[model samples]
Target: MTDTSTDRFDFALLQSSNERTERRNRRLLSWLLGLVLLAAASIVALVLYLQTFEREEAERQRVADGQWLERMVRFHLRRLEEDLLALAYHARERQTRQGSVTDLPAPDPLRGGTLYHQPDVLLQHGWVPWDSSAAPMAKALRADAALDPENAAALAVMQDTARGLRRPSYAGPLLDAQGQRTDRLWLSVPLFERGLFVGTYVASLSLDQALKAAVPAWFMQNHRLERVDDQVVWANDETPSPRPRDGSYYAQLELPGTQIALYVDALKTRTPWLPRLFFGVALLFLLGMLGAVLALWRDIVKRQRVERELQAQVALRQAMENAVTTGLRAWDMEGRLLYVNPSFCRLVGYSAQELVGRSAPLPYWPANQSDELELVHRELMAQGTEAQGVEVQFQHRNGYLIDVLVHEAPLRNAEGEALGWMSSVLDISERKRAERLAQQQQEQLESLGRLVVVGEVASTLAHELNQPLGALSGFANGLLNRLQGGRIGLDEMPPVVDRMAKLADKAGRIIQRVNAFARRREMTREPLELRSYLLRVLKPTQRERQVRWQWDLGRIEAWVDADPGLLEHAVRNVSSNAVEWAMRATQGSDRAPTVRVALVRSPQQQSVAEVGISVGDSGPGVSDAQREHIFSAFHSGKEGGMGMGLAICRSVIEAHHGRIEVGIDPVLGGACFILWLPLVAPVTT
Candidate 1:
């Protein structure tokens, strides 16, 4: 009985040990499987965040950019209206002069002295046809010459509005020479004099570059624009808003502060991927979670297989999510598209099925991007692997080019060698479009202002030229009469001949000045002494304004290779401007308006000498606001001037390896225009 009990005890001990060992193995297996599931879940979560949340961020950015463009356009429209008001004022003044055929009213003494000094600026090329692109007077003349009496009457009405300083806010189709009515036309404003409407001065701006700019790039981004015949005059950024109707439609809205009609584009087709991209993020996130759970369960069935399966599943899911959210596309070495996702397709206005395995389309690309596309392809194919983000153009089915920031990554298989490329296409089309359009508008505004000045100065230019000729004729006639009548003996003829020669030379010089001023200049340079030139140039400009001139430039050899004509013009222009200011200080006092000039060399630079040429008057200096951009192009502080002399002078000095700069707040009470030219030094090396 004792032996049987011992045997039973040993067997029971063995059985208990086996059951405990099996339980430990089960727990260890579960722990390993749990770790695998956790890693996979992490990867899946990252994908969900990247696709769903990040995509929303991108869309928000695009919308914000668009809204900014819209606001910009509105700003431009406001500025345009203000300019139109100025146009009206100008026209009204013209009509006042034009009305009542009695001899023109005697000019005010103060205003009359400076009236004929206005400068003429070039307006446009000869190729431009008669339309709104022409100046106010040019347009008016065209209207007066119109074949249709009704059209002429309408234009006449516009002229009256211009005369009254009102906006010319009319747009309609115009009849061309071929008798076809065309939408390409201009705005005509009527001019009014003291409640009596007189004539119309027609004015226009080029819509090609200018109109686009006035709409504002931000507005274009915010609206949808369908360019008819390659111009954006009819629509804006708001045109892209989603529409319920299946067919194309149009709506019109009156623009703020503008009588111009604004049309909204009603044409939109749902991008198959747009809806998918929107809901795909959320749905994929949930589905991905489910997939993670099922995948984890499968890993439990097999041990080593779990690592490979889980890794593969995570990679594929990440790829799919990236493709959907960030616009994934794959291309071969030959510049052919291998694959494209819904995101990329929608960006270019195409379906994935249409873009995949095709070459990059040219039509969808933004304007002027062929070279960029070609370079990208060459670089990618040459090195067998390339990754970069550069701007590219994409074509839409409707032929509009879309701007994009393209991100490319090399694709490699298990061998760890690059074969092809995968790219992320980001649509920056609206941003680029807005920026370009804004720039264009700014240029147009500048051009319009230039044209106005040019028009105002035409009469002045003719009078200015005629003065010298008249003086020469009178002097010649007097000389001829004296010689013919034998006013004295042969002895008088020498002095007479001398005076006649001087007078004739004076006329020639005046003609030369006019010719130089009228032509477009190509500044040429040669070594010129500064002291005498400054004195000679200043006399003509200052005496015209009756300003006394003083020069304190000590003996200095300021020899420099510079355009002599341009330099002389610069000195004259600045001196003239200073004299005007000085005269204004004393309220045009005949009591000697004085402008003093000083020249000094800087102490710091030895090998290079600084010739400081300054113009100082006994007048109040430039305003704080004006000082900042005193030398900037086309900026003027005074009324009825070209606003170009100082700016052009600055350009000339800088080009001659020097600079035209402002004085250090003109000491002792006057505005100063300072010019610094680098003197040519004797070679030391």
Candidate 2:
């Protein structure tokens, strides 16, 4: 009896346990079903929300595109109107000058050309005079207007409106022969001179042609354009449609003096499957929740590793910035300072804290130059950046001025959005000082060269003076001997005195030429007839040498503004050298030494005319090897020569804003030196 009771109790316990297990399994299943339902509902809600957002976005884009198209059309129209006004002004001027309007030139509607950003849309254009009896329109224009009585009436109304308002007026959608509306627009621009209406300039425009030329290809690819009033569908046949849709965008083209509207229809587009795609992704996400938990831990480990690498890159960049010596600076569009590197702080003798965030007319700018610097800053901000660097003076914190060269570049982010300006500043005080010192040294060298040229010329000048002085002395001595011997008669004395006077005059002329050349004086520029000046300068040199001189001063007189003394010296040196070389080359040859001097007007240079003084000789021409250093100081081809002559000549010519060059003369068959000076306008007396 005890065994039976034990067995029955065990069985009841086992059954209760099994029932409890079944109840727990059922509750767990119910909870899972509820979670799955919630997930599905959330996914549906998200899909609907995305669909709504997409519709809003598309609507916004369509509206924006319509506005842009309207702006483009209006801009083109504005340009066309400007071109028409210009044509009217030209017509008025032509009538005023010609004193008649009967033969006015045909109007050019698209006078501004590509500047109007449209193709030729004009069908007919002509000048319409105020009085039809005085001047009639072209036959073509007249015929076009007469094709339909409505067109003529519309043109007349537009002309009357333009005349009354003293501005341009538009009329039509002109009617066809069947009295049906066409895409033709008539523009009447009134021609007014001195507040009096002279006539009307009229043009017929094809609206369809205008639209095709004005709208961008990219815009037309997605939108079909049409007139708002007519609702005529205009489709682009060139580009294939990407999808299919039926929508329209509307915008008003706000012309300055006219009311016009345009209708832009969105092209056919396929319905987006983004909502369905989102729904599928959401379902997959719910199914992979356990995998996502594992992935989250792995992602956290990868994020930590990436953070460590980013910190290392940051440290490396900081080190590079510190190592760089060039001063780096940054500023915003408003001219407010944004950043400064350590090198910049060291250069300005100021800390980054004191320099960053500073605006224009900062502490580093010199007090007296603050206004100028601020103006420059404003211009830089407006223009973005300069191709060439700006050189400026900056004051250090210790009260010393530093010459700095700052190169500016537009600072942009990864998205190509302009942040401000980035500048690379370099301290150039030492370079500036060196440049000034070199300039001073060059001036000193030039002065010394002048002195050497004078010394060299003095020897030759004394030899030239000897002949005239000897003649004068001989004449004086002969006359004195005759008077002392009492052999001179009164008639004879006149002839003798005349001879002495001639010699005296020659000697005086030689002295005057020498004084003019040798005297060092400040530059005194004067307008000179080049022909006359060349004659005077070459006379003394010709007399000194026996070379066959050829003169070819053109009839068209060339004039120049030059310093007389300096110009004379340069001309004399070049001519003298030519004569000397000719004399030497012809010493043992059968060829007679010849020197050709010519003055001719040179071709225009940058709109400024120039006159060339060419001196050619029959001696050996300059060789290629010597041409490079021929004008250098202390470089001479002649034996026992002071090489400063050509150098000094070059300096003098450059001072007068002229240039000198050497080449082989075709006529003389020898080296030729040509001095070119800017020609001046002849003074009318």
Cα misplacement distance, residue 609 of candidate 1 (Å): 8.2
Residue-pair clashes per prediction, in order, are 44, 5
User: Compared with the true structure, what per-residue lDDT tens digits does model 2 show for residues 1-685?
Assistant: 3567555323222221245545665575567566767887897888788888779867877888888887887788778777877876777778767777777666444548433444459776656667654445444445657878867776667766889988788877766778776777877778777788778777778877888888877777777766643443334453334332455676787532334566667775435567667767887977765355446546645655555566666666687789898899999988889999899999889899897888877888899899999887887787745666888899999999999988888999999999998999999999999999999999999899888757755653554456667877887888889889998888888887787787678666655545555564456799998888899878977887898999999898788889886788679879988988999999988899999999866665557677889999999989999999999866888897757678768877887888999999989899999998998889766
Which sections of candidate 2 miss by over 4 Å? 1-315, 368-379, 382-388, 413-418, 436-454, 457-685
lDDT of 2: 0.76
TM-score of each: 0.37, 0.39
With a 3 Å backbone cut-off (N, CA, C), the pairs that clash in candidate 2 are 243-268, 244-268, 244-269, 245-268, 245-269
C-alpha RMSD between model 1 and the true structure = 49.9
Worst lDDT run of 10 residues, candidate 2, spans 8-17
- Best of the candidates, lDDT: 2
Question: Candidate 1 on 541-612: residue-level lDDT in tens?
Answer: 655666667778887556666777667756766777787778888884556667888886767847777787
Clashes of 1: 44
CA deviation > 4 Å runs, candidate 1: 1-326, 332-339, 348-376, 379-392, 397-422, 428-440, 455-474, 488-562, 573-598, 602-610, 615-673, 677-685
